[model samples]
Target: MGAFDMLSIAGSSMGMHQTWLDSLANNIANVNTVVSTSQTAFQTQTPIVRALAGGGVEVAGLALSDPNGRLVSDPGNPMADADGYVRAPEDDLATQMTSLVMAQRGFQASVQVTKDAQDTYRSALEIGRR
Candidate 1:
């Protein structure tokens, strides 16, 4: 692949991972958000990454978790219903944390790849100066 192609691939990977990280952050942030039993709780979103026909990856779309969140008993909470129940997100903190780490690593790796590609390109230019 050409220097530009390598950089573009790395850039695409970084973008996809960044989007994934963003969604994971949102999910973690709203993990404890509660709503009235009659309302839908915050739904977690997952980024769907797809490979391009020529090269690189992209975030094709977002897949959302179930809207019908689990019911929790928080009698004292104002958002609780008459039956002392409220809707809480079904997101699992452990899963979200693990995904966060994976996405971070992926982003870092892509950055490294981009840097390496640039360094190689620079080295080629220096050699041509001889």
Candidate 2:
């Protein structure tokens, strides 16, 4: 509606994208995690974003991906099961990388919006002072 409102919206978007990027990074970091058969494998985390009433976004919660991971046969590994199989996180590196790129772009767009809004406000103030 207003310049300030636009800035608020951009700020909220930036925050939401930051959360998304953080979750993506976490998922990527644990992509190669190996766990014992008895232990649960690292589950990918996704940020749950929701639109606010006025005009903004918020991270409502975190959604965990399926806990079922891939089984890797490693006879020499200590954490392997009786069948010499270890559970590895089912994280897809390609998907995580793609999501990371999207989030980065979203964050950059929001930053640009905020910067533009600020510049417009500054120019208005300068014009008013003239």
Q: Please name the candidate that would achieve the greatest lDDT relative to the true structure.
A: 1
Ten-residue stretch with the least lDDT total in model 2: 63-72
Question: In model 1, how large is the Cα lDDT of residue 34?
Answer: 96
Which residue pairs show collisions in model 2?
A: none
Over all chains combined, what TM-score does candidate 2 have? Answer: 0.91
Alpha-carbon deviation at 54 in model 1, angstroms: 1.4
Give stretches of model 2 more than 4 Å off: none
Error of 1 at 93 (Å): 2.2
Instruction: Predict model 2's lDDT versus the native.
Output: 0.91
lDDT of 1: 0.93
Q: Residue 108 lDDT in model 1?
A: 98
Best by TM-score: 1
Model 1, span 52-109: residue lDDT tens: 8768999989998889989999999999999999999888889899999999999999
- Candidate 2: tens digits of C-alpha lDDT, residues 61-100: 9999778787889889999988999988776799899999
For each candidate, the alpha-carbon lDDT, in order, equals 0.93, 0.91
